[model samples]
Target chain A: MTQPDKGPVRPRHNVKIVRKNNRMEIPSSLDYLPKVDQFVESKLKKLRIKKDQLVDIAISVSEIVTNAVMHGNKNDLGKKVKINVEASPSQVEVIVEDEGTGFDPSSVECRLDPESLLKEAGRGILIVDSLMDKVEILCGPGKGTKVKIVKLLR
Target chain B: MKLSSRDVGDVMVLEPKGKIMGGPDATVLHDKLHEFIDQDKKKVVIDLAKVDWMNSTGLGILISGLTTLRNNGGELKLANVTDKIQSLLTITKLITVFEAHDSVDDAVASFSK
Candidate 1:
């Protein structure tokens, strides 16, 4: 017997996302970065932010979350990365916390140094700082890291 | 992000769509660039016209490709960088590190010059 046509065959994605209260939690893995981006972008889009400002916010959030996952949590699958977003007409704030021993924020290398120009990494925090209006990094040895960034809508 | 590549003369043009924020998707572009390098097709042009926006991870990937190619006696250039990415390059001071062109044709033509 011939099977009924289901139109064009479409690929299926087995994606499981966890979110609550304008926040999201994911295992410390870069594989979940897109989910974080999607969650944050959805929240910001509702505020009707300008396209450029929205992009800036999204980029800043991605940078913070990446650091949380890669550096703060050391990509430990057992650890968790939490992202909380709060927004208003004038500004948006994002907080990403990781469950791992943190490092000195001042230790972050400056990518603008001539010697570091071609380095493949160490640019995320700088990019985040440049894109957001205010950035607060709270972390220390044996303490988990929490990065809070605020961007003023233009 | 989605990546597609085609050859324009001796130059390889890579078109990556969507956001290049990190994750498994970002690795696709990184691996593709290195794969091209392994195949000895090193003169590369990344067409950023279709990319909506990318975080520092994307920029790192570009730098990785550029440095790898340069070290191997090849080179990488960028074509059609969007406003958002242009701003990013400027803020990060990477604007001086890359060769950007108005179009893929121009970028391709540049490899000959």
Candidate 2:
């Protein structure tokens, strides 16, 4: 929403429909992570988010989106991933939703300790949490995972 | 990710360009790092100034290199860490783990110390 008075809060489902405004729809593919960063960075710049802050938010969003595609959706082309961004006066919220079984964040062992440092996986979620102001993960037996990441605007 | 390696004196400097995302890119760095280890070249310096950015996957690669070298009685160090990557290390508390230098020459010099 270009209007300053009327906020830009909208739901985007289809990939085609996301092209309407500030929203971007990404496929359930990890290969698209960089593209997602490019889109988010440009939009954040338009919102006057600083370069450092932009990188932090973009990196956080990428981690969440990558997890949704690789872990939740399992990179299934049949499944879909929707990313919606809503910037209010106070903060900016980006939601990454996937049509797959959800994961428990607590179950993940980040292994930041000395022994686990050499390992490859498990740092995605931890880094996201540290970078974002707020990270909310919602999932159920039948319901897919929805990750809401919010960054305070400065 | 693209990798370029050259020998500076006895040390090996591997310059990886582009984002070190997961998938084939991860394997490339892993294999190259190990390749040097296999050759008994334990002293290594990874120049990160040219790199655009790296996710956890990139950090993992660095960890893998560090440990592998330590096991071989060699060591791995980082040079020219960009602001973006430095922040990632700081947030993850990895800034405490890796020794970073302002330039490649500095990192290479640290190996002697």
* Predicted structure with the largest lDDT when compared to the true one: 1
Which docking class does model 1 fall in?
acceptable
Write the residue-wise lDDT of candidate 1 on A1-154 in tens digits. 1222222211133444569989898888888877787788888877878888988888898899898989889987778899999999889999999998988887887758777787778888888888899999998788799999999886
List model 2 lDDT by residue over A1-154, tens digit each: 1112221112233433244366777667665666666676666666767666666777778778878888888987678778877876567899988998776766877766777655756788888888889989998866789999998976
**Candidate 2, B32-106: lDDT as tens digits:** 899999999999999998887788878888988898899989999999999889988887778888889999999
What C-alpha lDDT do the candidate models reach, one value each?
A: 0.86, 0.78
Count of backbone collisions in candidate 2: 0
Model 2's alpha-carbon lDDT is: 0.78
Residue B60 error, candidate 1, Å = 0.9
DockQ of each: 0.41, 0.21
Clashing pairs in 2: none
